[model samples]
Target: MATLMLQGTGSDVGKSVLVAGLCRALSNRGLRVMPFKPQNMSNNAAVTSDGGEIGRAQALQAIAARVELHSDMNPVLLKPQADRQSQLIVHGKVRGILGSSNFREARRNLLPQVMESYYRLSKQCDIVMVEGAGSPAEINLREGDIANMGFARVANVPVVLVGDIDRGGVIAAIAGTKMVIDSADSAMIHGFIINKFRGDPALFEDGYQSIEQISGWRGYGIVPWLSDAVRLPSEDAVILEKPVSSAKKRQIIACPILPRIANFDDLDPLKLEPEVELVMVPPGTPIPAEAALIILPGSKATIADMSAIRDQGWDIDMLSHHRRGGAIWGICGGYQMLGRTISDPHGIEGPIRDIAGLGLLDIATELAPLKELKAVRGTAFDEVLEGYEMHVGITSGADCKRPFALLQRQRPEGAISADGLVIGTYCHGFLGSTALRRAMLQRLRINSDGRDYVASVDAALDNIASELERYVDIDGLLRIAAGAGQ
Candidate 1:
């Protein structure tokens, strides 16, 4: 089938990024490669070229592979809406909301769809690099698991376990995981890869030998950490809050830390500015008043997180800043929170609750039954804004009064108050475009040097992939794909 699996020791061990690099590596070798994830759980998603929504990581991988994204690449997506409830997207469409416990039991019913998607990708690509979610040794969830060992075992695909040495316990994490996996699933593991290695590769000689001796899995390679990875657009919402320093003017920008953060790459383009620093302030941290601008980023649980905003004291800070004539901008879920009131009639976020918003803009929002998921092209802040639409609320009345951006057919989408201090939009990538980013920052009295955000990110991926290709044995991976010993 020309398919291989990339399994990780645990979550956020760099499996997704490695898969992206390998996909680019293989594609650079003149082979058509595609990225696949049997199952994924994240609220941050991407709209495909075909107008379907899939995990954001898979979308980035597809971009790295230089292939068109499709829903078949990620057939099962679980976007958590609450602690125990999630909105399930099967084969690219919403099926409904299910509690986490019920979702686990219902996952088995999607196995057929999983296999079908796998086989379809197999037929179309020269090689399909599959990403396994979390750890394969999660024995408790392994019974109903379709992401790691379960998918690998069903497809009989060889696996390369990626362990992050930077996280510490590299030896224990890799060996312990191997020791606990079922015999059949263990047999599918072709080799082990030590990723994010900081010191000399030779320094890990003993550690490499020990992993082989203990797990009986060959050591494929030891990849050093890529420092310039800032060029690659991040899809993991967890890492979106890292510090971003801009070199253009040496000023910092902060985004209001939302609890249920999603699709946070909206700030990535700003990172390209050499003089700007993008700071994602989570709850408890004080928002600096000297910052050039404050953005209220997207979120999954708007009402719940809005409550978090008030609890974290940001609501008070925002109010204090607004009176001082500071600029406040919000996108998507953040846009909903800028209104006067938000009502959850369908109880999508909570039990049909209604809450007061920041009141920056004179508007009201109501959570709706239908979700909006599609790629959108519009003009915002005097620039062409290209991004996907994903939300479950409708803003109405005087709140939706001013139009911030013109969508297809020149329809106004969001609003800008008469004072111009507060602006809100449903668009996510408004800041990615140079014209839009410049316009918005100019309105805040901030000067910026333009940057080619997308090109710089793609170039970073290319450099990282080229470096990894030089160290890893490509022929060895092909042999494993052919069901042979490396």
Candidate 2:
């Protein structure tokens, strides 16, 4: 088995998409490929087939590789719930909370577990596509780092540095990485790939050569801006920092961008609706009164996000919108916040034990040790809704009588209000269903484009794979991977 790692010159340099494209390219060549990330820090998570969660990006890569999602793909996940504290997940289960104080030491100790995952993946695949989080340039974090060169050196995996040309510092980002990182660490990096080039590739020929000359790294390829990437599920909330869609449409759907929002991509499918505008309301912005539907999104820390909602006075906006006859929906943690109260007696989410909910539904939630993680299928909106349930908490009350969907085994999932104006469900990816998306849009009295969203994403993977095959040196990368353990 062989392995090659892709590390970025800086954060968001297109490592995740590049890895996914490369995974599909290699898999198309009849190579058994598996994607691996030693450590990832993102609130956006995907429930794996093994009843654990991994970074959403790895899940996309696995899909590109035509393999089942595995928690071992990302062994250590840090979900930031606060400025300094993070929720720690190991091998598909929540271990505990990690604060700034013990973050380094805790990660340092997990090197063994990370390697365990890497070796297990190696046993099952001909080549493993390893992804590095952030940049290896941050020498300050290199002490106990498993996200970048630290893992590269320990595993003896060759690294290919990726720099973002669209960011306007491609030369410095690539060459300077070599200047800043230790000599021993720099030895792991064998080549560089320039990503997100907007203009003619010929315009930057000299610059690309300069990077190779200065960094003493071989040039892999220069990738053009991928417009289809918008169709893929984003792996980080940094994409949300951009302003809301300015497109004018017939109906409006509003959602708040919570501080610790997880799986927010559940709404990405809705963005494809031409007649509907999906507005993501940021902090200090009121939920638009013109929106026909208001969606309370999922959060990593329910109570804290609820507190933040109230702090932002969105609670008042929701009530006023409700009186005006606007529909409301909640998913996962948002479902918990729609209830009467949420109690965390065990302090699972810090000192805030119990907090008042929006009281839109009669249900109440109690946080428990065991997390609910599974794929589910059922009929909702008169369409077959196939999605996953990944959350922590037990919710039940009179609203349960009006279950949103009749899941398998006659199990009731979610709750619907008596007036049919409010609905809440624990299932994520509900909107990914084309029919469900059409149903939701029909409620807004708009028409869906009737696109098979799931298949579209699948096609997108193949498309990206074709691009990588054309531009990137897949054979060269394979040769490097073949050199592993030599």
Candidate 3:
């Protein structure tokens, strides 16, 4: 099998974006390439065509490669549940909740499954470019690490080390990572790429040579920062904090940044509206006094993050906003937080066990046995909405009296308060659709020329792919993957 691995010096070093670009670039050369990540730790997940949950980044990569997306691309996924604890998902199904100490043991048992998925994809694609999860220098995690060097070493794939120059310490990061990796894993790296470089590329010529000498690796390329990346939907919640100018009407939408943020993509549709400004106020950021709406984003750690929201003075801020006639919307975990109480008897989120919510709505939530996962079509605020559900909470109480959306041939999915100002839903990505966005904007007396969000992103990807085709040695990359070039 012809395979290559893209490992990073550290997290958020542009590995995910680079993989997407390379996938598009290689596919443009008339070769079929598939993106794979042996294991991933992300709350931002996408539903597969066959009805499975995989990392959102891998889904983007699949689209870039022009291939059908599948859960096999990411065999293992960990959704954070509490401090150093997470829900383990294997091949799209939940295994169980495990602490950080137990994940390694679980990973050892899941190796065969990982191999099964890898070889299956290997046989179906011309080339498989695998992306590693985090830094290889995390020596403390080296023994039980299945996502980085561990998987790369077993898969026998050559590696390309990608470093972010924008983060500074490009040379030190690359050199330090090399110094810490196992000898065998270090040897797998054939070359390195300097990513997210700003200013002139020639300015880094000397630095590149110095790095090459220190690490004894060849310089593959220096990739400049792509400014149009904002048009793309980001899977990482940490990267979604860029602020935009508020609409002329000054109608504001606020999102409480929960500890285990997940599936925040529900706001994408609202973001495109000219009359809407989506503001994410993390813990400690004071809520604006004149804000009209507050949104509570999805979180993996519902109970714990609810505590975090309470600690950040948001609890007080939200109450003040509500008293001022401001509207509040919640999704998934946030939906649960709107209720009077949340009972986590199983310790699914943390050691503290059960907790109370903001009580904005008259609902009460209990962590449930079965996770709801389905594509739902529904109605909310007189607008037809379509989204996917992925939550494990059963809600009840007076606020549950009004349904948020009409779904699946007459079933309603979500809660709408009597005043119609408070809304909560378990569905994520409900706003990415243009129809939904336009309707939301109209509610605020805002006018907008709706844009096709998905298409705009696809066009951006096409542009990046075209640019990469002109710059990279496409044929040489193919040959290298085929095990012909050194």
Candidate 4:
């Protein structure tokens, strides 16, 4: 099978999006294609069809390729907790927790596992598109690096380096990478692609040529900034720092940005609504009282994020908002924080202890060692909604009797307060369902335009694929994938 890996000059260089767009584009060309990432470090995760979890970006790429979600797509996922430690997931199962120092050593040992997944995928597909994490230029990290060049070298995969021109220094980022890396590693990269270019492409014609001349790598193409990307779920928390909606929107939906926010892209659909304004309230910024709904998103560390909210006075703000009859909705860890008490005897997150929750709901939760990962279908507000559950807590109390939704598993999930103003669920992506979105807007007395969010995402993927056809050198990329390129 032909294999091509896309590595970025640095993080957030549009490598993931490019890989996704290319996957869809190649699939459109009637080629059996698959996306692979040997290792990924992100809290934004998605439940796979295999009843396991993988990085959300890989999940999105699978959708783009029109394939089933598989944990083998991302064999090694590192979800950062705190204290320089991360929860390591190996082949869709939790292996254990490892600190920074130990993780470096552990990663080398996991190479065989990574290769096994890669080989399995390669055998099933005509072309396997691999995505590299961070930059391969970090010589320090190159020793035990299963993420980029190391994986490329082992798999004998051709690499195409990508640099974000919008970030500036596109020339140095590409050429510097060539200068810093070892000769063998440098030889793996056949060509380079400049991403996120704005304005006239002619302006950068000289610059692109300079990169080609300096690095002796062929110029693939330059991709312009895609506005349609907003419709797709972003996999990084760095995107949460900026405002997601315009201030002029009539209805305001505020979400407090926790320190270790996970799966914050659940708010992406809300940003698409014209009348709805979505705001991410950072630390020290109080939740707006005028907000019609305050959504508490999932967190990698519930206790620590809860403490951060208290320290920022956001807990008081949420209480005040609740008193004003504003709606409060929590997902996963946020749901745990909304309960009366949260106990972690095994210290799954941190030190063994119990902490008081917001007490908005009568329920209590105990963090467990076993995590639940499932793709679920359910009904909320009498509207059909589908989402996935990925958490490690068991909640129970009198309030659970008023479940927020009836799941497909013939059981009630989540809880609703007696006042009907508080709702908490462990499911993520519930709002992406059109029926649920409309019902939620109606509850807030806002007009619904009846948009199909799933269709919008599909259309966005098609648009990205179309753009890739126009901007990227598909023929050259295909040749590179076939191991026939310089």
Candidate 5:
């Protein structure tokens, strides 16, 4: 089996996107390719075919490779609950919360588990493309690092470093990484790829040669800016800081950018609608008054994010929107916040206490230790919608009598107010279904475009693969993966 790992000079340097594109390109060549990440820290997660959860990026890469989703793709996932603490997931199951200090020691001990997953995946695929988390240049973090160089060293995987030229300092970032790291780690990186280049690539020919001269690493070709990336689901919440769309004269769909928002990609389908303008209301900004729909997205910490909404005065603004006959929808943790009461007596998320909810739905929820992870199909407004459930609360009350959808054609899921203005559900990715999206738009008295969201995503993957094949050295990369060049 052949293996190649992609490590970046820093975070958000297009490493994940490059891996997805490469996976697609390689799979298109009739190669059995698989993507792996020893460790990942992100709240955006996706349910796998094995009835478990992994980082959302791995799930997207699996789709690109045309393979089944598996928890082994991402063995160690850390979902940040606070600045210093996170919930650790091992082998697709919650292992409990760990503070910053303890997590380091725990990570060192988890190396065997990570290797086990990597070996199992390598045995089944012709090529395994591994993605490194953050940078391998952080010497302080290199001691117990299972994310980057540490994993590369033990797994005997050749590494190709990537730097974002659009951010500038591409030469220093690449050469500087070589200067700081140990000789063994530095030797693992055989070549470098410059990503997100907007202007002429020839203009940077001198700068690219400078990096090759300084680091003694070959140039792996520069990748131009990918415009179709916006169609793919972003794995990081940092992307929410920027504007989603610049279009005007369209219906507005406003969503509050919670501090710990998870699965905010749930709004991606809505953003693609030509008739809708998706606005992510940042902190301290009130939800737009003219927004036809106010959506509360899923959160990693429901209680804390709920408190943050009140602190930002979004609660009052949402009430005003509701009074004006605007539609409101909440998913997952947001659904918990829309209920009458949210109780966590066991302190699953923090301090043990019960807090009042938005009171829009006459239901009550109690946070539990066990998380619900399942793939579901249902019908809402006479349209079929399929999604997954990843939550930790159980809800019940009078409003449930008017359920928002019939899940699995028998069980009722979610709750709707008697007035039919507010809807809440634990299901994520409901809008990905074309029929459901059209029905939702019709409910708001808007004409539906009836676009197939799944087809759009597939087309975006194909576009990216074509871009990679055009610029990247595919045969050279394959040789590097086979250890022929090294």
Candidate 6:
């Protein structure tokens, strides 16, 4: 099988989107394709059909390829729980926590597992599209790096460097990358693509030529800003900081941005609604008092983020919102926080043995060593919905008798308060289901546009594929992929 790697000059330079678009473009041309990432660092994740989890980006790319998600798609996944500590996932299973002190050495030792996954994936498809993380320019941290050039060199995968022209200095960024990285690593990059370009391509002809002359690499193409991308779920947290909306007349659904927020993409469907505005409140901000619904999102560190929310006084704000009869809902770790207490005797999530919850629900939770990662179909709001459960705790109490959903397995899940204004559940991605989502929103007196979320995402993929076909040299990329294997 053929292979090619896409490495960006920096993170969030459109590498993930480009790889996904390329996968779709190739798939449309009747080639069986697979997406791989040597390592991925993100709290946003997707549950694979194989009972594992991979980065949300890889999951999107897998969808683009019309293939099932697999743990082999991302061998090394890191979910950061603190400033210097991350929960390490190796081959789709949690190995343990990894500290910054032992990160380099431990990561270097993971090369075998990375390669094993890559080789297994390569055997299943005509071509494997590998995505690199961060930048090879971070040479100081390049010693034991398995994310970028280190993986490329070992796999012998030819690279296509992608530079974000919208950030300016496109010429310097592409050329500077070559100047900084070692000669051996530089040789792996076969060409460069300037991404997120604005205006006419002819207008930047001179700048494009300068990049080619300085870097001695062919210019593949310039990609314009994709407007449809907003329809798709975002894997990077950087998007949370950007100014997204200004509409005030729409109904508001506010969610706090915890330090270790996981599965925040659950709000993407709401963002797509013209009459709904999903506000992500940053740290130190009050949860909007005017919000019609206050959603407590899943977190990698439940107790820590719960403590953080208290520090931000969001707990008080939420309590006030509840007293005002505003709807409040929690998912996973957030669900744990709605309970009377969260006990962690095994320390699965950290050192604290137990912590008091918001006490909105009568339930109590205890973190367990076993993590549940399963896709389930359930009935919520009197409509059937598909969602996945990815968490590590067991909750029980009186409120649970008033379950928010009943799964296909005849299991009662989630809880609802006596007043029916508060709710908690462990299911993620249920908001993507139109009927159920609409029903849930109807409770708050909001109107949904009745759009099919999955179809919209598929259409977005097709649009990106069409754009890539128009701008990028897909034929040349295929040739590069083939040549590398030969």
Model 4 bad stretches (over 4 Å)? 245-248, 484-486
Deviation of model 3 at 98, angstroms: 2.5
Clashing pairs in 4: none
Greater-TM-score candidate between 1 and 5: 5
TM-score of 3: 0.92
List residue ranges in candidate 5 displaced over 4 A: 484-486
For model 3, the superposed segments whose C-alpha errors exceed 4 Å read 240-250, 350-354, 484-486
Residue-pair clash count for candidate 4: 0
lDDT of 1: 0.83
Clashes of each: 13, 0, 1, 0, 0, 0
Please write out the lDDT profile of model 3 over residues 275-309, one tens digit for every residue: 66678786668877667678898888788888888
Model 6 lDDT tens row, 1-486 = 899999999998999999999999999999999999999999999899889999999999999999999999999999998889999999998999999899999999999999999999998999999999998888987988899999988888999999998888878888889999999999899998989987898899999898899999988899998887887788999998887865654888999999999999988888767778888999878888999999999999999988998999999999999999999999999999999999999988778589999999999999999999989898998998888999999999999999999997779999999999999999999999999999999999998888888899999999999999999888888888897754
lDDT of each: 0.83, 0.90, 0.80, 0.91, 0.91, 0.92
Model 2: per-residue Cα lDDT over 1-486, one tens digit each: 889999998888899999999998899999999999999999889989999999999999999999999999999999998879999999989999999999999999999999999999999999999999999999999999988988888889999999998878889888889999989999898999989988788888999889888989999888888877878999889888876555576688899999888899999888777787888889999999899899998899999999999999999999888889889999999999989999998787887489999999989999987888899999987798999988889999999889999888878899998888889999999898898889877876779997887888888889888887887888888899998866
The C-alpha local distance difference test score for the whole of candidate 6 amounts to 0.92
Report the lDDT tens digits of candidate 1 across residue range 90-170: 888888877866877788778889999998988898889999999987898988789988788788889999999999999
In candidate 6, where is summed lDDT lowest over 10 consecutive residues?
A: 241-250
Task: Give TM-scores for every candidate, taking all chains together and pairing residue i with residue i.
Answer: 0.95, 0.98, 0.92, 0.98, 0.98, 0.99
Worst 10 residues of 5 by lDDT: 241-250
- For candidate 4, lDDT tens digit of each residue in 326-419? 8999999999999999999999998998999999999999999999999889799899989999999999998899998899876899999999
Runs in model 6 deviating more than 4 A are 246-249
lDDT (Cα, tens digit) per residue for candidate 5, span 213-255: 9999999889999999989999998888876546553888899
